[model samples]
Target chain A: MQLSPSLTQLIEALRCQPGIGPKSAQRIAFHLLERDRQGGKQLGQALTKAMTVVGHCQSCRTFTEQAQCDICASTKRQDSGLLCVVESPTDVLAIEQTGQYQGVYFVLMGHLSPIDGIGPKEIGLDILENKLQQGGINEVILATNPSVEGETTAHFIAELCHKYQVNASRIAHGIPVGGELDLVDGMTLMHAFTGRRTVSQL
Target chain B: MQLSPSLTQLIEALRCQPGIGPKSAQRIAFHLLERDRQGGKQLGQALTKAMTVVGHCQSCRTFTEQAQCDICASTKRQDSGLLCVVESPTDVLAIEQTGQYQGVYFVLMGHLSPIDGIGPKEIGLDILENKLQQGGINEVILATNPSVEGETTAHFIAELCHKYQVNASRIAHGIPVGGELDLVDGMTLMHAFTGRRTVSQL
Candidate 1:
C-alpha cells in the first residue's frame, strides 16, 4: 500500500502484543494515528520506562520496580507466617481480589515441566527453599492450578516444604461454588466426591 | 493487587487502545513483561517515533513522515489524474490491496456529520476544491462507505465537483458477489435491483 515508513513500522511493532494479529495491528495503528495520538504517546512513554526500569521483585518474584513488591515489603504480611505459592503473578491478583487471604506470596512464574526444560530451579524453588530455611513461615499454601503440571509442581514443592518441617497444604479442587453437577467433567466430579466434607455433624 | 507502579501504569496506558478492557489490558501487560520485552521496547520506540514525526501528507492527508505520501510522490500516480476520494486512510489501504486502482487519493479523514459540527473545511473539502480548481484531474471516484453519512458526504462532494466541471462518480452498491439472495438485506437488494446492468443484447 506504500504506507508511510513510520506508519508501517508502528503497525509491525503493534504485532508484538499477544493475541494481536496483522489485521488487529493495522487497525490499532490506524486508530492511534486517526483518533488518539495522545494515547499512543502515553503508551510509548509507559512502555519505554517500564521495559527499562521494571524488574522482578526479589522477595516474591512478581513484577516490580523496587527490590521487593509492596506485599512482600509489608512487615505485617511478612510477619503473618503464611506464604502462598502460585504459578504466576496473575494468580496473586486473583487471590487478592477475594480479600480472604492474609499472607505473602511466592510466584513460581511458571510450572515444573521437564519437557520444557523447566525444573524446581527454573520456577525459583531454590529461592523458596532459602526462604523456608530462614524459619519464619508456619504453613505454605499450594495455590497452583489443578492441571497435571500444576499438581506435579505442587507435589514437588510439598516435598521440599516437608524437608524444611513447614506445613504444606494444597488448595481445594472440585466443582466451583455455583457449578452444576451434570455439567461438571468426570475428573472434577471425582475430585469433588473424593474431597467431600460433612455439612452437618449429625 | 498492589501491583508495581510501572506495571499498573503500563496497564492503564494499554487501555488507550481500541477494544481493550481491564482484563485484556492486564493480560497484554503481563504477556509483554513475561515473554516479549524486546517487542515491547520496539513497540514503544515505534509509537513514540510515529507520533512525533508522522504528519498528514500535504497532498492526500494520509499519515506520513514526509511532506507527501509515497503514492502522492509517485509521478505516474499523480499524472494518472484519477483521484479516489475516500473517508479515511484505511479506505486508501483497502483500495490499494485490491491491486486494481491506478490513481491518486484524497483522504477526508472522516465522513460528514453535521450534528457533530464537521463541515466542508473540517473534512478538507476546501483543500479538495483548491485541487479541483487547479484543473488537471479527469475523474473523481467517490469511494466513501455506503452509510448515510458516507452518502451525504459523497453527494456534497459531487456537487462541489460540478462547480469545477469535474466528473464525479460514486462507487457501486449492491449484493456482494458471493452473497446469498435470502441473506441480503432489503436495502441492499433494492440497490442491486436499482443498479442492475444488462449482460447481453439478446
Candidate 2:
C-alpha cells in the first residue's frame, strides 16, 4: 500500500543524508511507523529544536545552542595561544573524540573551492582573520583534510596568517605505520623516503 | 568540540534505525546542522505530521492517512474476493513491486513470536480474522517470508483460515532463475527439484 504523504515526504527528506538510498529510506520510513512512535515524534522534535535552538558560535563557528558553543565559552580550555581550524562541526567532533586537543577550534563552515563558486566570504575566512587580529592565538594549526582542495584552502589561510605576522602550520601527512614498500604509491613512496628519520644503529 | 545537548540527543535518538552506526549517525547529525536547514525542519514537520495524521487502516491494517488505506479504498483495483496477508508494510511494498497480483492485501504488522511474547492479539491477527470473515474472501494467500518464524506464523494463520472454511495457500518456493547450483542451499534445491516444470523437447 502507498504510504501517507507526510511519511513519504519524511523518507524523501531522510534520503538526503549520506548513504541513505531509496530502499533503506523506505525501510526506515516504515520502521518509524511500525515501532517506536515516540522515537518518531522525538526525531521530529529534535530536528526542529536543533535547527531553531542551535546556531554557529560567532567566535569559533562551531554549533552552539546559545550565543557561543561550549568550547568557545569554556574557561578550562587552554586559550594558550593555539587554535585548530577545520571545515565543519563534524570535523570538530572528530577532533574532540581524540581527546588530545585542549585548545579551541575555528570552523570554516566550508572550504575554499573557487570552481564551485565557494570563496573566502562564503567560508568565513574573514572571521578567521578577525579572530587572529584579536590576538592571544600564538599558533594556528591547519587541520583541514589532506585533499587537493583542503591543501589549497590551507595554503590560502597560511598566506593570510603570514601577512598578519601570525605563526601557522598545516597538519602532517606521510606514510602510515606498517605500510609496505610494494603497496606504497609513487608520490607517497618518494615523500616517505625524503622525510625518513635517522634510526640509532645497534 | 563537544556537540550541544540537543544535537547529542538527536544523534542518540537516530541510532534506533537499522544500519545507522555511530559514525553515520554523527555525520547525519552534523550534516543537518550544517546544510539543508530547511530540509531538517521539514523532516521534523513531516514526522510530527505523519504521526499525528496517519494511523492503521481498520480493514487492511496498513498505516493510512485516512480510515481505510488507499489500496483498500481504491475502486480501480479488482476486489477478486481474495485477500493476501503479509507481515509488515515492507512486505506490502515488496509485493506491490512485483506487479503480478491484482487483489488487495491485509497487513499483519508483525508475526506471532511467542518467545518474544508476541501473540495474535499483539499483532492484531484477531482483527484480521474478523475482516476476512466479514469480507467472505474466497481465498487467502499466505505471502509471509520463507524464514522459520515466517513459515511457522504462516502455518498458524493457515490453520485458522482452514477452521473458518476459507481456502488458504502458501506462496511457492524454489530455486530462483539465474541462481547457481553451488550457491543454492539444500532445502531450496530440494524444492526446485521436487517442483520441476515439464518442458517440451527441442
Best by lDDT: 1
Task: For residue B143, give model 1's deviation from the true position in Å.
Answer: 1.0
The DockQ of each candidate is 0.78, 0.72
> Which residue runs of candidate 2 sit more than 4 Å off their true CA positions?
A75-78, A190-202, B75-78, B193-202
Q: Write the per-residue lDDT of candidate 1 for residues B32-107, one digit (tens) a residue.
A: 8888899889889999999889899899998888899889989999899899999988889899999999999999
lDDT of 2 by residue, A1-202 (tens): 5677877887888888887888888778788888877888998898899888888788888888788888888766645678898988878877888888888888898889989999999888998898888777788999988778888899999998888889998776678789888887887777677777789999
Per-residue lDDT value at A108 in model 1: 97
Expressed as tens digits, the lDDT of each residue in A86-135 for candidate 1 is 99999999999999998999999999999999988999999999999999
Model 2: per-residue Cα lDDT over B1-202, one tens digit each:
5678998888887787777888888878788878878888988898888878878888788888888888888665535777898988778878888888877788888888899998889878888778667765788899888888888989988998988889899888897889888899999988788877889899
List TM-scores of chain B, every candidate.
0.95, 0.89
Q: Pick the candidate with the highest TM-score.
A: 1
Error of 2 at A21 (Å): 0.5
Q: In model 2 chain A, which range of ten residues has the least summed lDDT?
A: A72-81
Estimate TM-scores for all models: 0.95, 0.91
